[model samples]
Target: MTDLATPGSAGLLNGKRLLITGVLSDMSIAFQVARIAQEQGAEIVLTSFGRALPITEEMTRLLPAPAPVIRLDVTRPEDLERLPLEVTRHLGALDGIMHSIAYAPPGALGGRFLDTPWQDAATALHVSAFSLQALTASCADVLEDGASVVGLDFDASLAWPGYDWMGVSKAALEAVARYLALYLAERHIRVNLVAAGMIRTVAARAIPNTDHLETIWRNRPPLSWDVSDPTPPARACILLLSDWLSATTGEILHVDGGLHAVMT
Candidate 1:
């Protein structure tokens, strides 16, 4: 569902281009962003990895028009090195990047933090936290002067029932966003995060007892909460990426139906 008020020319993202990662299915937050961004006149591309490539290629075929899917497994040096070149080849210079990638090994979640191994912890940090920095640095040269960088986040302020290492990874992700915002200010680039509430995405499915977390939100949020829909958070991301938020950076804009602001 798009707002009809937006013009064909003054599209929220006219002439702007964005690269979105972590789009595995139509229910993905990245998928929502890609759809809306294109509807608003932004050129877009998707990135996938390894055996997941065919899945991404299949998904893109569902879009209104076909868009390129580039290879990017953030931890792989070669993939990161070629990302900018690949995007430029398909979509020209980047005006925005969506760091929607994050992962944690099975052993790292659903237990005491102390039980987590360094290897698993390190994997979480690299994929969930450091990937943001890697994506930004790799594409920095091609990023337009007022480029915006956005990532999907879940609040890491406290421990959760089964989030374990992923909770820690989220904390690191937040810090990385702030540091990037500070450092990239000189380049007229903005870095920010949308700390969205849990939605039933493929990534969220990895978290143990995620449905319990969603059930809790149904009764607690100030505004209505919908665990099934990620469009609200997706739209919020487009706002932060657009020129409308030129002055906003290093901020965590919560799109959790106001849950993060209230206390029981």
Candidate 2:
């Protein structure tokens, strides 16, 4: 295994034990973070679900080291209940947890926000927002002192062409993090979100007109963007999970290539 330097000392996450979710493919931001975290000497345990377990297991081998996998379908009560023990069996205690999971039903995207069903919208909010809290609750005991919780998000202050319900989900996710920040602070645990620009992934492919949006980002962003790369945001997640951001909590760190600040 590759060894990383300690936080400001350089090995940022050295000797940390982190739990990462939502790694469906190599293009996933969580996958990249897991890779870099391991390179920096952190031990990682991954979470996946039923049919997707095999895929995530395959992807885990691509990390800097082979990681143990735990089953976690946030939508299921049983899975969440079992996750803690399953993870502990692999790694004694976790120093950090990364929430890279988000989902919405098919009709939640595209140009049909008004046509989207309540069930789908509810699913989005639950998976994208509430699950953060749920995961935190389940993993709280295992979290070492001064632990950190990191989540992936998109800027949700405005509407985007095809993001519809998922945009709503992200906004809710931001608020959820803030609330988690308040509750976990007394325990010396921090919670934060990273608002990243659009990146091509299995999840992004579900959004309609991604190509058109990519073209817009290419011309509009002051810093160039690569839709295929999620490493930038992944690194940002690593910093938040490390001691470098000890005082930072309930905040949104933008890793969008400065797209949020540039004026069209």
Candidate 3:
């Protein structure tokens, strides 16, 4: 197991203010990123919506410092419109934003690709792909010059057995990041993504045939891939959020233990 550094020991994000979304539980990648960001000296505000709000709120208590949770349902136009004021009320101008949100309904995932209804597929694309644009644009007024935007991603280059509509959504996400990077460049804002290997998160477990995907990662990567631990990808997110990668944008940094490079 790779040892996670003590929070705040590195100070990589010292004095930064960030808005992080998609933290449903401690097991989530966003949770770890928020935890480490606080340890590294960032003041972060988190977002959750509806029934999951309380769950995300509870997870914040486990962070190095408890962060305030704001309600944001990306699919709701009202929520997106109010996001800037809500975020500004908590943390003034943002230095970074973490786009860790994605979802596909039961009807859209788990080998239901051919049988899935158009509504189900559209919902998946709207929530998983277009939400990045919605969230960023909503927060644009509050984003500081040179702010960084990082989104979590699964490799969409090849189809995984049961990934289904979520796979299509991810490909859309990559394209969105590139366009955001191009347009946001005028403000010196950087937009990038981290394509990660499977980790045993609540979200990952929801995808069908995850066991098969995990097995492939375990066997193919040149480097040892731990599906149990999320530290590596969390660290990559922190790096992108920091000033160290000022020149990098519209890029997908793979923290997938070399599985992305090896052909099966």
Give candidate 2 regions above 4 Å deviation: 1-10
Q: Is candidate 2 or candidate 3 better by lDDT?
A: 3
| Winner of 1 and 2 under TM-score | 1
TM-score of candidate 1 versus the correct structure, residues matched by position? 0.96
Error of 1 at 207 (Å): 0.8
How many clashes in each candidate? 0, 9, 1
Best by lDDT: 3
Per-residue alpha-carbon lDDT of candidate 1 for residues 1-264, written as tens digits (9 for 90 to 100): 555323235578887889999888898999888877877778889999898889989998777667899988899999989987898798789999998999999989877578888999999999999999999999988999889999999988878888999999999999999999999999889999999987999989988888789887798888998888989999999999899999999999999888888895
Error of 1 at 78 (Å): 0.8
TM-score for each predicted model, relative to the true structure: 0.96, 0.95, 0.96
Q: Residues 1-264, candidate 2: write the lDDT tens digits.
A: 233553223478888899999899999999988888887778899999888899999998787678988888898988888888887888889999999989888898887899999999999999989999999998887888799999999999889988999999999999999999998889889999999888998888888988987887778878988888888899999999989988999999998889999787
Report every candidate's CA lDDT: 0.89, 0.89, 0.92
RMSD of each candidate relative to the true structure: 1.5, 2.6, 1.7
TM-score of 3: 0.96
Error of 2 at 47 (Å): 0.5
Local accuracy of candidate 3 as per-residue lDDT tens digits, 1-264: 432444555588888999999998777999989988987888999999889999999998899887899999999999999999988799988999999999999999998899999999999999999999999999999999999999999999989888999999999999999999999999999999999998989899999999998898888999999998888999999999999999999999999998888886
Candidate 1 weakest ten by summed lDDT: 1-10
